[model samples]
Target: MKLELGDQSGRTAIITGANSGLGAQTATALADAGADVVLACRNTDKAAAVANRIGAKARVEKLDLADLQSVRDFADRIDGANLLINNAGVMALPLRRTADGFEMQFGTNHLGHFALTLLMLDKVSDRVVTLSSGMHSLGRLDFDDLNWENRRYRRWRAYGDSKLANLMFAKELARRLEASESSLVSVAAHPGYASTDLQGHTESLMDVVMAVGNSVAAQSAADGAMPTLYAATSPAVRTGGFYGPTKFGGMRGAPGPSSYREVADDEAQRTRLWQASEELVGITSPV
Candidate 1:
């Protein structure tokens, strides 16, 4: 199936973590659809390579999602983005903290995107697509211990929590956009079990686990990216919707509604998350 990004010609899109994996694929697809793509990444060289591969109209920028200031800097540099793809994220990395001292996974995977989204909200007039995960179903937000400083830190659990936060943020953003009657739309998609370098963060887990998952369950990065592309481009897409692979336990196949957690749809929790996110990021949403 092919994607038609209608009216995308000459439009600009900012894709975080566009240097590799699913983000890179999305960048390519958007470029192919005639959108001018900006590759926001920590590694400028890697991002530049992807931009070059995608050809002209694709440019690279330096961005560190773990630093709020960096996110602000990146936001300040751009104006009028038709699409914002919050695709940059870290996986099961060792316990650490962001530049602001929050748990690294939570800070980078959720809070950073939170800050960036708010900072760029006014400029993002069309849509915002966050990369979420199936692991979010196993996650439950920890309001009391968001940092994991006073609690035990299991890598996967922290990753799961962050992914859940990503979905929650998208859902909440959509609600706010609707309430304000803004043109912006918010949606989310997961890559399911896409094979990518993100596994390097979990090297301690064992190659057999990674290999089996990649071979039996994982889709190619391009294949996994289709859902996000769909959410970003499809006319049938609805705000606050979640999309992912439709095959075996959501491990592969075409774009469709993926199973989401009840907690993710909790309005009270989402509201609290919005407030906490605003306080943490110190950026107010336009809504």
Candidate 2:
């Protein structure tokens, strides 16, 4: 049940938010496999520390997923890569807005990656891997109020919607890539209950709750990242496929096919979300 990575000497991979947690674990694993790794993160200092540890094969780049300009700027500097992992995200938090004035979670988790992937599509020669969540099943998208502008804002629900959007975006991108006859593939993965800094940003009592949960019920960030690495590099992965841990209800174990909410498979919704995302991000779909 172990996931083995073959020679990746010729590959280049860009991973967002690689300063810590699952992103850092994924970056280290790939670099160890001989891939050139780019830690595309907002915090250059932390990312630099990670790159330094990975030695000459890794480099740090500034990428703030909360701002579109940052996303664009990050994409502009990337000449090419074999993989682009849309791995950065925020979890449940009090209502907030991005620089573009979109809901913080939805904006950063989905639209930000949306714009970056499209902007860098031509530069990515192999695949795009997006991170989703087991919590996606609890999400119900109100496209009309995606930004939480007209509704009661619930932090957990907002997080769920964003993660659901992540899954939807990956599948839609895969469909468009196939239709365009492109070699690039899009796949999705989830960490299940990974213990990471991501859960500490809630800025509320839940932070303490999640911290306790992490100590008691979560897997290590390295183990949690296995699904992402498997999706990014595994030949067994299919376009639009989702992967996660195979044991303890998909929370921790070997990587394998993972179940997603049925709503995530709705074709019409996927297309509609894609169209709306394009309009929101002001980018035409390259696929």
Candidate 3:
């Protein structure tokens, strides 16, 4: 990825999950480029530390995507954001429910960010960058059972579904923006394999696999943050564009356009996902 960053002075950005990992690195880089970076996080203590390191141009706000109320409250408290970076998410884990009683990964990763983006729509001006994953290639959205309410939960599949939703949301939002003649363009990015704390919580065979992969091929968190930065700030990013590392099976290298699953190409399904998201989140967002 290009390490060179263009000037983004006077722009304000809200980066979810900015407490650590790729989010934190992205926040730091944006701040260094003179953008006001808001570290939206569930953990204010960690966020505060990151903000301090980011110098005077940084601020911290509490944002828990897993809770609709939390997302609403966070949106209301902020204003004048030129960018909304949907960088927070969860990965494979045992079956669990969020505060809203939806599957944990689906709730926090897709629905949570889905609701947050709409609530934040009016506040953003330039663009919104939603983070997906390389694993989205394996995802299939079960629209009939979005929460896995009628099916057995598979942790990896749940994670894949959420990531796929991220791409779908990005594309759908781009379409809406175009239809409404809005200035906002929705883009997606993947960090590839990055070594971060997100890997420390796995307690299954997948944990060992993640450990081995990171040790052998993963880049540092700073390197991982580049594709997100590119999507958020690069002039080359187009509406519905997806960016990721381009070498080693997209696990590491320069940030560039990356391939998405054919599953993400269905516009009808994107519309359905949008409708389902609005109903699930209890809000009718303006296009």
Model 1 alpha-carbon miss at residue 128, Å: 0.4
Q: Write the per-residue lDDT of candidate 3 for residues 1-287, one digit (tens) a residue.
A: 44777898999989999999999999999999989999999999999999999999999999999999999999888875999999998888788899998899989989999999998898889999999999887788898999999999888888899999999999899989999999898999999999977776657887888888888878999999999999998888899889999999898998999998876878999999999999998989799
Sorted on lDDT, best first, the list reads: 2, 3, 1
Q: Could you give me the TM-score of model 1 versus the true structure?
A: 0.96
Q: What TM-scores do the predictions have?
A: 0.96, 0.98, 0.97
Candidate 1 displacement at residue 48 in angstroms? 0.8
By TM-score, the candidates rank as 2, 3, 1
**Regions of candidate 1 where Cα sits further than 4 Å from its true position:** 1-7
Quote the positional error of residue 70 for candidate 3 in Å: 0.3
Pick the lDDT winner: 2
Top-scoring candidate (TM-score) = 2
Per-residue lDDT value at 53 in model 3: 90
What lDDT tens digits, residue by residue, belong to model 2 across residues 1-287? 34688999999999999999999999999999999999999999999999999899999999999999998888887899999999999999789999999999999999999999999999999999999999998789998998999999999999999999999999989998999999999999999899999999988999999999999999999999999999999999999999999999999999999998988889999999999999998899877
Worst window of 10 by summed lDDT in candidate 2: 1-10
As for TM-score, the candidate ahead, 1 or 3, is 3
Q: With candidate 1 superimposed using the best TM-score fit, by how many Å does residue 39's alpha carbon deviate from the native?
A: 0.2
